[model samples]
Target: MSDTTTNGAADAAQAPQIKMNVLAQFIRDMSFENILAQKGTGGETQPDVQVQVNLDARKRTPDHQFEVVMKLKVDSKAKGSGDQLFLMELEYGGVFHIENVPDEQIHPFLLIECPRMLFPFVRRIVADVTRDGGFPPLNLETIDFVSLYRNEMMRRQAATVPADDSASA
Candidate 1:
């Protein structure tokens, strides 16, 4: 009994503790183009806006640090002519500290949880940039990271699987 207890205590001391933190955050890239500015001043009606979002994350050189980025591209066009009114591109990223997580779980943690923490900041930046570009503030809707991750997983799997022509023949 005494030997077992001593061994358990020794094992506990050697195990790394689980922890995570946001070390830094920044706007990696930002661009706002009022495409209409160069064109003649014509009375154009309200423009329709389309926003696209993409996410990427990677483990940093250090074993426990990671970088997560959210990229947004917003294009606004005149409803009638389909002429671009404005084009905005934003890339925001954060450095995160994560320790003692299992290797199998790292991808999900970085893709889902890390992005959730960083989304609000990125959203605010997007809104501010649009407002500054002579348009109303564009607030982005909340994203479901879990669903996005699952869909991405499915896409990767589908890409790897070769299409079966055996059945058709």
Candidate 2:
């Protein structure tokens, strides 16, 4: 084979390749609570709804697989009474088979891309469960996993910095 042809084949073999295979997807845990059920439906005033979201991922031992979990907590409280209205907490997870990814890129692949694949399903479940519980369906906004991951990295970096060096020496 010519030198140029040989080098072309070698380059192709070394090129980076990535794949996401969902071996299984399931809800690790989920709960919905209507604390004010007996108190009757909310009045003309709309309740304040608060939401918190978290994403975490880990590699399964002795394998190239990983598990990613996304948690969403929604709390709605009456505007005036402050009495509890409804609370929904969901923990959604998926088992992923990742291969041919470099070590430096694995983290983002798991945290950003994996949960991305799972977000729509989780969103649907939240809406359905809330509707079934008698409240208006809660459709969560589309999450930007990339932004979340970057913010987490920034927080971690800040945490590692020494605090108040003047006090040390």
Candidate 3:
């Protein structure tokens, strides 16, 4: 029993603890074009919006520090008339300090976890930009980062298979 207790303590001591912090966040680029304002509207129109998301990450000069960027493209159209309403593109970036994560997991962690931490800010910016552009505030739904990461991985795998097959032939 004493040996078991000592082994458990040793295991606990040997386990690595994860530490993470958001060092900074900023909008790397942003653009908004209000098409409705450019083209005169005749009557009330309902808005239909579509949003696309992409993520990128890179290591910084400082040890354990990384930069993650979330890119968003939003396009809106009139539901009834099918006329273009507005378009917005934003690149939001965050600087993060992370320690003690296993090397194998760092890729997914940067793509999923880092973006998860920065999502709320991205949502807020989308809402504010839409409202300021003369449309109703557009609230974004919560994104599933894990699903996104999985889909991206699958896409990358699919893209590489053909190249690998060609090389072998």
Candidate 4:
């Protein structure tokens, strides 16, 4: 009984604890164009908005520090005329200090968890830009990071798999 208890205590002590900190976050680049105003087509038309998100992560100069970038493209068009109302592109980045995560997991951690920490700031900026660009505030819905990560993995896998040419016969 004493040996078992000692082994359990030792196992607990040897387990690594995960730690993560956001060192800094900022908008690397951003642009907002009000196409409606440009075209002088100022009418009370219904607007349809679509947003696309992409993420990238890379190791920085420091061994433990990583940089993660989230790219967002938003386009709004008049529902009836199919004309662009506005277009916004934003690239937001965050520097993170992560420790004790397994090597295999670091990729997912950087892509998923790091972006989650920076998402609120990204959302706020998007809303502010749209409102300032002469449109109503466009609040974004919550994003599912896990689903996004899984989808990206699936996409990459599909790209790498070779198609069977024998099927042409």
Candidate 5:
């Protein structure tokens, strides 16, 4: 064979075969705190709690790898006294292997499927943390990941749309 053809074949053979495999899957780390529950006494003071949930995901590399983390913060206080009763924060995350997927497919898997897969674990962590913190288990509301991701993409696209006749043309 000609040198050019031989070189082409060799390059193809050396090319890294990209196959996505879950090299490892586990909770890298976790933290849950309930300082208020520890400090105050159990009373019939009708406590009120405000809870906030934040979700975020990021790609660790250009290849098939990503991390999805969910965070929950709950602030509780006595209804009348306004004294802090309990504060709990739970942070949980998961690592995913996503390889050989085209750019178009990557977004869906990263935004939708990865979060869906990680949600149950994160939810469980929240519940367990709250229970351990001497409060009723926190059952998180179910998330519609696909819709959430699509809405985010649409919002971003809308924000970047050129604003004027000149730009449009």
Candidate 6:
């Protein structure tokens, strides 16, 4: 090939094209605590487990890319004494390079696939935290990301709708 043609090909290859891929996947931060241990030592009763899950998503850039992060906090307490037994928090995220994808594709990527990718790790953390706390290892039930996402959207929509007051008036 001629020098000019070869140079043109090189330029094309180096051009910043929209390539979609997960750049990094990991637990950005994690915390697990055995709260009951602070109260006393030895022969403590099993605590009631309470789990709280929070879901959030935001665009990292105005362009066709985003970051979806799921934060889960679990707290277990002794029912009678209200003494905390275990506390765990997991922050997980996936960096998605989304470009030129249609609107339909975006929802599934953010709401469904992203959470699915992060769940196993979150599950493992929960189980380990309980086991480490000296309780039987807790197994978290599987989460339905699609249903959760849809319910969230519905709740937001419902909140925005103005209630009819004529009946009360």
Predicted structure with the largest TM-score when compared to the true one: 3
Task: Give the distance in Å from residue 72's predicted Cα in candidate 4 to where it truly belongs.
Answer: 0.2
Cα-based lDDT at residue 30, candidate 5: 55
Model 4 score (lDDT): 0.93
Sort by lDDT, best first.
3, 4, 2, 1, 6, 5
In candidate 1, residue 89 scores what lDDT?
Answer: 94
Give the deviation of candidate 5 from the true structure as CA RMSD: 8.8
Clashes of each: 0, 0, 0, 0, 1, 0
**Per-residue lDDT of model 4, residues 40-112, tens digit only:** 8796879999999999999999979999999999999989889999999999999999999999999999989
Model 5, 43-64: lDDT tens digits are 5666687876556768886566
Q: What is the C-alpha lDDT profile of model 6 across 40-109, one tens digit per residue?
A: 6646575787777776667786576678788888888778878777788888877777665567767766
As for lDDT, the candidate ahead, 1 or 4, is: 4
Hey, what RMSD does candidate 1 come out at? Answer: 5.0
What do the candidate models score in CA lDDT, each in turn? 0.87, 0.88, 0.95, 0.93, 0.71, 0.75
Model 5 CA deviation exceeding 4 Å by range: 1-22, 25-35, 38-41, 44-53, 75-85, 158-169
lDDT per residue for candidate 1 within 44-156, as digits (tens), equals 46888888878898878986899999888989898988988889998999999998889999999998998999989988988888888777888889989999899999988
RMSD of each: 5.0, 3.3, 1.6, 2.7, 8.8, 8.5
Spell out the clash pairs found in candidate 1: none
Question: Looking at candidate 4, what is the lDDT of residue 71?
Answer: 98
Off by over 4 Å in 2: 1-14, 38-41, 163-169
lDDT of 2: 0.88
Each model's TM-score? Answer: 0.80, 0.84, 0.93, 0.90, 0.61, 0.71
User: Candidate 2, residue 73: CA error in Å?
Assistant: 0.9
Q: TM-score: which is higher, 2 or 5? A: 2
TM-score result, candidate 2: 0.84
Cα TM-score of candidate 6 = 0.71
